[model samples]
Target: MPEPERKSKITASRKLLLKSLMLAKAKEEWDQEIVDKQAEKERYLSERVTPLHTSGLSLSQLQDLCRELHEKVEIVDEERYDIEAKCNHNTREERPVEVGDWRKNVEAMSGMEGRKKMFDAAKSPTGQ
Candidate 1:
């Protein structure tokens, strides 16, 4: 016969797993929102705002427009950075150990030419 406590513990774990899955889905949605915000910012700035400015807005209007743009840009950037920081934290926490000595070579070579040499060596059979 199964223990009552064991059955309850399984139920609790199932609830936790469901909650975790929902949170992961929510994070994916938030990441998509960040991507959408970036695209909208780019499109609005390039297609709508720039053309409007070039089409002859008055100096005061342009100044006001600039202020509005700055505020919205700052807000979007702040939200993006916040979400990205959270996502980055999750990624860093979940990262696996690197497989090879690439880290050591990167540290040793720390320059463009040195990196090129390493890359060239990696491509050669003699180096292998």
Candidate 2:
């Protein structure tokens, strides 16, 4: 009947209520998880039993085919490296740029007009 004891009883009741609410929420989440897992299992089983739209290859056969394809791709990559090595050995001569005439050549070329136009278009409409 004392004020401190009454406050302690109220606090204890509140703690019990909070604990029960948390447990209820956890139980709901657990139930939903179980339901989702069951649905996923059913879907997987259905897919396994049903004929696929593509080649009706079994899981094992598909795995073997994937392995074979991967091996073939690796062989192709090795051959490409060998071809690249030979090509690298046979180099073509490249013309060197004259530093003195570089500025003149760049000014004469119209290739930079597109870049200038794009830059001009990106300017603020208010001209800020």
Candidate 3:
């Protein structure tokens, strides 16, 4: 005879591949278990805390009531005025332009014209 054949006792690559396959199967089982638990939780919540069956009003009715309340709240007419002047200016100015009085303008805008118009004779500058 020429020679006798030899054989190895262990295979490291085969052992590593088996370990990885087992790990992948375990991860798949774990993912399925998590999905099952979430489904059970959803079912429990649907059965126990269903607001649609418990409340006398439906979802559309509740939405309509909310809209009506919002409309009612927006009905109030607000009178706003701006009397504050904000600026990043640091200067020495004499004074800002001032209208004499609002009461004078009202008297002028009324039917009482001619010499009786108090605001008609008054002259003021532009914005301050």
Candidate 4:
């Protein structure tokens, strides 16, 4: 096999070409990692928040809601995948999970306030 001639121009171009290829490969890897992370995060959030409404609903109603949410979640997941696939993300991170039911807080306060209101109402304006 004959050895190929190494032209100066070709050799010079190959370095830039290889460098650009390396950069592109690094960018592809970074982009895919970002998308994978985002998909995981979205999966975690969906697991956490989307099922709360079913806690108070009836069994049949809950089943219906689950079905609807499943469809919606699928759409959201697909769109998220599509968007993340095309995105050039420079930043990414996972968040901690935390949830609090404020309605229960309000209900507790309302129960307390009701007694106070009743007591005030019972106290007549004229204490003859």
**Best model per lDDT:** 1
Best by TM-score: 3
Off by over 4 Å in 4: 1-10, 52-128
lDDT score, candidate 1, position 58: 83
lDDT-sorted candidate list, best first: 1, 4, 2, 3
Q: Return whichever of 1 and 2 wins on lDDT.
A: 1
The alpha-carbon deviation from the true structure for residue 26 of candidate 1, after best TM-score superposition, in angstroms, is 37
Q: Write the per-residue lDDT of candidate 4 for residues 1-128, one digit (tens) a residue.
A: 99998767667678999999999999999999999999999999998775465467789998897898799989999999888865634224334446789897678558968667667767868532
Identify the runs in model 2 with alpha carbons over 4 angstroms from their true place. Answer: 1-10, 51-128
Reference-based lDDT, residue 72, model 4: 92
Angstrom error of the Cα, residue 14, model 4: value is 0.8
Candidate 3 per-residue lDDT over residues 21-124, each given as its tens digit: 99999999999999999999999998976454327888898898788767755663221112122222322354566868888767666756734444445533
* Candidate 4 least-lDDT 10 residues: 88-97
lDDT tens string, model 2, 1-128? 66554345458778999999999999999999999999999999998665435388889988987897799889999999999887776544344545596776566554677567656667859553
TM-score of each: 0.33, 0.32, 0.35, 0.32
By summed lDDT, which 10 consecutive residues of candidate 2 come out lowest? 90-99
Report, for all candidates in order, the number of backbone clashes. 0, 0, 0, 0
